[model samples]
Target: MSARGFAQAEYEARLTRAQALMSKAGLGGLLLTTEPEIRYFTGFLTRFWESPSRPWFLIVPAAGDPVAVIPSIGAALMGRTWITDIRTWPAPRPGDDGVSLLAATLDEVAEGPVGIPSGPETHLRMPQADFARLRAKTARFLRDDAGITARLRAVKSGAEIDRIAHACRIAARAFARVPEIAAPGMPLSQVFRRFQMLLLEEGADWVPYLAGGAGPLGYADVISPADDRPLARGDVLMLDTGALWDGYFCDYDRNFAMGTPDPRVLSAHDRLLGAAQAGLEAAQPGARACDVHAAMARICGADEGAGRLGHGLGMQLTEGLSLTAADRTVLEPGMVITLEPGVETGGGNILVHEENVVIRQGGAQILSPWADTLARLA
Candidate 1:
């Protein structure tokens, strides 16, 4: 199965760190409900989360191992983890769900405020009605976890960085073979479909996200779904993907020219590469996220108008901090982020370049195979 999850000691260290932070925040316990939060503490990884029929809960106490209060459907997998105290009930119980068991457990474990992740980018996976019932069943006040989860997830461990780098390597191999599936007269949609197959062939566990565009000048936007338009001699093709390896994602993209691209587009692509290089140099420990964004922004000028230039990446395709003029989040060692820069190429289109990188003590380390110039196709 794409490598057995992390070692037991890894989870132990995570729990110890979380408990220390919880105690300092004056929290009796933490109530985790989302997939990332639950998987972060326990090594319980499952595709059953896609069903969304049952809710999963993990309670991180002030001093010990986390308690997994999950559905019976997941007990076997949860048992495989390091957790010993597990509580389960037949899930989808209409009126109660797991609310009664969950609340009672909360009452027994938490004496002070129960911390829930209520900060930006956080989510409550359970139903709203059940959450209200849970609140009524327990006397504990549900307060924000004070960004504790985000703080810990922002900086990855050595093991996590290895997985991310592995994912990047898989993607890099797929990108190198793009010429085998792409050429003039080929449909853009087919290229997208074939690129996904290449990712799997190159050893990606899964490809959860892929986005790109093609145009005679540049694409109108990056997020638009691929159409049936066939590539022309003058077209500029870009493929951006978020491919996974053992649940870690590598998010970056490549630009290519069909036959011969416009001179303006080629110049814009080179400038985009230059801007990304600028971002790489600025990504250093103690530097704010905006500092890196400003460096790239200086070169892209007013062309990089697709919101932020880049964002943090790891477990999810995009997470934690952002590279924007307004975000002052400090960069730190072991934090993986993307350097994406773009520029206008006349009309309403734009040319962009992106690369995955991890902040290190020396500077920044490139995770994706670095590209200096635009690749061409006949």
Candidate 2:
């Protein structure tokens, strides 16, 4: 049971909450196709999602245990989950995938309106053509789920928070070892590869996302995919990673100077730190996401160009609410988010700093070990 990411009670509670919401929305069942939503209901975790060869589906009914309508290959894994009513077919059947079986199951479980996650950050994993076929085969219309999954997933359980925090600790440990592998003359690309190894060495199950840049003043962009540029004395190297641990992710970054730091770079780094602090402080349970963005933007200056200062992260690297002026999602206790602040250095370069935190009753609690100083490498 410890090996599983969450207990059975967690899944039960999720289903109960979702069913309650479904009843109010006049929904008979909820259709889930994507990895996160399925795993949210059932603890089916697998890297097999890497292959798009087959499609999978989970049906959350209005009053009973969710059903797994998946390929034969996944029946064994789905059995490990709390789900019992497993339905399967030989996948990739060319003209007739799982549409007939899926339509039948949907008809049996759902009465009137079956809801599908139709909000931002949600998508149907099945082929569009198959989905059209499914719609034609089934009697009930698949409508929007009224943001039930998003709202429920926004506030995590304590068990979920612990997993995320474990991932953060792994990334922080790997960051501390950066000096051992980085210095002047190291190619930025090699640095990226070696840093991922460090993350695995520390404890990450896998390093799904690692992007960074190196420049004199600052990196032009934080999402740089690492070129062959070498580190220099005044260069500021930034590495942002999305490392996973037990299906949870820790998303943050660290900045380090190659040898000697430039005065301008130091000033920009200090401002980023201050802005991150402000954002963290403003992430109280009742504050809106835009409020967090505004607090950090004030310190980074009003005309910052990085778009979003930070975003929510959990099973997926970026989900839920975003820390931007346009997002007004209220911060709730147990909502995990990142406070990333950036400042424009000269020549279109920007210095960005990020920290992972969870909204608590009083304020945001830092999951990653907080830092105030910019690190330097020999």
Candidate 3:
């Protein structure tokens, strides 16, 4: 069994926090199934998340020790987590009575109104049978799936900020190393692969992964490299990479013009830099998150043809808080966000730049300290 990563006191504090949220929401207890939230509360990381045959459930009451219900085989791993008072069941085989075990566990702790994180965010995580069993037990059950969790996560703790900062540095350093591996006439995919390797060597847990190609215009989708197109003179190479450090991710992107730059590319690059700068400047205490987007949108214009500015970053590669005019979530201190400004023409000439920042009292503080200037690679 793995030793507990957090102290028992720390786990108690997390339970206190969860209970407080439940009280605020007028609920007796909460059932959380999200792995991130589970890991956050219990410091439990398991490879068994990949196995559907064995599932884990965390039942937290507003007034008692947290309960972890999982497979009998997984009960041993629960010792590594800070949480105690575990409930176990044998693996669900044909005609197995998993529901009896779940219902028994729930009945022991739940009273009054219980909260479950249902709907889109939670349906996939809970088994249909398990969900039905819980619903049948409590008539006062309400949908509170991830409601409190999102609010808690919005204001990151000091440890989380440190991890994000470390992740940001890894991404920035990886971007700085791009010039050495890129050259005109090399395939874009090759450059991407080399960049990924560099990130891995820098202690990043996974490839930051990059994309964009040579052309007169821009395209969508940065998840995969485009067709094996040979780099050409005056081609703008836009690279977007996300570094995963300590289970957190930092997304950073930059643009490099191969050979001599065209006037259009230079002008677009300037616009991107300006937009990114404006977005960063807009991040401050009490400012609505959408207000930052409105600032950047002003510079990028309402062109549906061009790429949108940047979004937020954290546990996932692309965080939902958009820096666009439509997003109105107020900005607050301790929030980390990404501001990426980009411009792409129909001809493949592209321009983009991104940076991660932590919102502070005065304004946003840049986490990744890389050059703001565009790179020209010949």
Candidate 4:
């Protein structure tokens, strides 16, 4: 499992790649506190971050291996990773929680400006007061290196792609059992619970996100939690999940009708599938992200007020690259992204179809089982 999750070489390669980017950006080192970024360099994987009571820190110098400065509870786990120099302190303390230690570590490792992710979709995972204190201590060496990290992580390795594909496969198997587990008159909340259990049984490490809606025309929103509304014949039901395998995530959704769907719903599903096809055809190694968006938008219509059609997926639920008209990030081989096309189906409702794929030299290789037709669950 350790080899499958990540070998020593994988971590070393990641660290080397990060150091090269830091060199190009003139950064002395990188200070990472986010869960994904920390795990990217070291093979430290744990669900302990859900508590958020203690902050963990990893410092990657421009030359050597990473150093982990974290709470005492995580020392054992961090010891198991490729990282050797581990620093720990009692966490959740009233005032001085690891700030001084982190400052000293940063000062020792980095001489010039140090990089931290401060751009889009990134968050500082520690207490604001602690951050303020750390900033005051190391004020002279701070810079935004979100782009440096983003560019390095956007393109995945073969192992990373396999992990993501395994996650996608787990979710797909769970989706296949929805027909067996769901029935008319069952509450949507119950469906969510049952489906999550199925995902776990089908080999998912966890189901971090599982949300969707059910309506006659479709659902008004896709991100809302499951409700007590009972399924009825002709209601279109959707379930979007972010399932994890090892530490990688698969972001995709599936749709089902209680009985026979409306002709229009079927037509909309067809259009969404066609849009995915167009997007897949355009997902070449050198194609811009906007090109993929435009190809899909041409089939799904440009009025999708659902923001970006899709986005990068791997370590987090959503990563750096976004498929939109404005984003110009070039697609590269080994980048795993979702092609999600949502269509407004009148009555203030919409239908969203999603599929995960890896950009290969040839084209987009589908990871999840293809939804050839809109499923009608009896």
lDDT of 2 by residue, 219-329 (tens): 777776988877887888899999999999999999999877788899999999999999988999989999999999999974346788888989999999988899999
Q: Which is the winner by lDDT between candidate 1 and candidate 4?
A: 1
TM-score of each: 0.97, 0.98, 0.86, 0.97
lDDT by residue (tens digit), candidate 1, 204-308: 888989999998887999998889989888899999999988778999999999878899998898889889999999999999999999999998874546888
lDDT (CA) per prediction? 0.90, 0.91, 0.69, 0.89
The clash count for each model shown is 0, 0, 13, 0
Give the per-residue Cα lDDT of candidate 2 at 208. 93
lDDT of candidate 2 at residue 323, scale 0 to 100: 85
Q: Tens digit of lDDT per residue, candidate 4, span 59-176? A: 8888888889999999998998878999999987857899999998888888679899898888889888888899998744778984777777889999999899999989999999
Regions of candidate 2 where Cα sits further than 4 Å from its true position: 1-3, 302-305
The all-Cα superposition gives candidate 4 an RMSD in Å to the true structure of 1.4
RMSD of each: 1.5, 1.3, 3.6, 1.4
Alpha carbon lDDT at 343, candidate 3: 66
Question: Which 10 residues in a row give candidate 1 its minimum summed lDDT?
Answer: 300-309
Residue 261 lDDT in model 2? 79
Ranking by TM-score: 2, 4, 1, 3
